[model samples]
Target: MDKLAELKQGLEETWHSLGEGWRQLRDRASEALTRFTPVNRSRNSLEDAHSPPALASNWGLLAGDLYEDGEQIIIRLEVPGMVKDDLDLEVRGDVLIVRGEKRVEQERGHGRYRVRQCTFGSFRRSFALPAPVIAEKAKARCGNGVLRIELPKEARARGRRIEVRSG
Candidate 1:
């Protein structure tokens, strides 16, 4: 085989791997509550674990749940190692926006890191609400590595048909 053809084949294979990884991540986004960072083969093993790689994607699942129960909409997000002050929340139109930065805590004593699996940085996740909600009446709380929010669904207007008479 020619050298150019060999290089093209290798590039195509790499792209396929990247596409599959991204597809799996997106497909399981709603159900999985774990974070993932695909190792960049091009970079040396000594590089930073948090470096932005393939497709300029950072790492953080920020998994959460959104559901409606009767008159309210409930949202729960897994945000371990954080307090209420570390996160931010907002309601925009039919979407709920959650933003936060996860900073790595410093240890008391000096020690060299042997293993690192955590991804830290700013992340924003937006969820579309199934029903309208009253943003002013929303209440949220963060505790036990989880953030829970409840928004009272807006009262939907009832439908009424007007009778028409021929003149």
Candidate 2:
């Protein structure tokens, strides 16, 4: 029975080695897949949270939402880590343009960073209004890292009914 016992022990060790090899293969495959996958800024919020900043590109991505409430179109953007003075807003024709620059400050005495994810760069986001707005009367406010832009729709764009006249 000595030979049989030795054979059984050898088989157990081989099984464990095979299991480890499978685990390593799975981990390597998962990392390769993640590296190749393209991240969609609009759909994947969690990925954006952990993703490193787009340093290779000149322009950084800006996330925002546009909606219409009553007679006004409200646009809210997430512009964290920036001051109001760094932003510029303009209305040209039917397009509302927002331009801003985010500067990243690094102290000289600070220790090395293992992971830097905060994005810093110039970004421009332009939105086309659904209806004509009074450009001169537009109002914008930046508070708590959120930029709110309110544009009032033109009087003509508001639903108006014309009386039917019998010929």
Candidate 3:
């Protein structure tokens, strides 16, 4: 009877340990899924007030819009929390390369981080122009956390009219 009771106690302890292990695994998996899932926030959401601007990833992809207006091609990029000095742009052939770095600033006191969604690192985005452009005459400006680049299109050659000759 004594041996049987000891065996039962050992089995109970083993079951509890297994239960605790399973709980830890479930919690870790839950946290990982939450961290990786994308969350869409409204433009005027209060969450945006305290948290930094959301980036696509650590090496985030720069988001921009490219359009043409008559003889000029315009490109606008959203680069919040960045200064003009942090960005670099270059036009190589028909590709426009934009590179920049985002630095993380810690204002709050050091403590355990519950959630970390903000990203900070170097990012580069390249765009191929739809039409030939005069890269030398391009103009760029940054204002209100947006970068605007204006590229003048190359003049198209006009078709020449030929006079008909008598055979």
- Using TM-score as the measure, the top candidate is 1
lDDT of 3 by residue, 93-145 (tens): 88888877666544454443345555555666777888888889999998888
Query: How many residue pairs clash (N, CA or C atoms closer than 3 angstroms) in each of the candidate models, in the order given?
Result: 0, 0, 0
TM-scores, all candidates, are 0.61, 0.59, 0.57
**Candidate 2: lDDT over CA atoms?**
0.69
Ranking by TM-score: 1, 2, 3
- Pairs in clash, predicted candidate 3: none
Measured with C-alpha atoms, the lDDT of residue 90 in candidate 1 is 94
lDDT digits (tens) for residues 23-131 of candidate 2: 9977655422211122333423212333444422333345677898658889998787787898899988888888777665443433444454455555667788888
Model 1 over residues 110-133: C-alpha lDDT tens digits? 444444456655667788888888
Instruction: Estimate the overall C-alpha local distance difference test score of candidate 1.
Output: 0.73
Candidate 2's TM-score reads: 0.59
In order, candidate lDDTs are: 0.73, 0.69, 0.69
Question: For model 1, what is the error of residue 68's alpha carbon versus the real structure, in angstroms, after optimal superposition?
Answer: 1.0
What lDDT is reached at residue 45 by model 2? 28
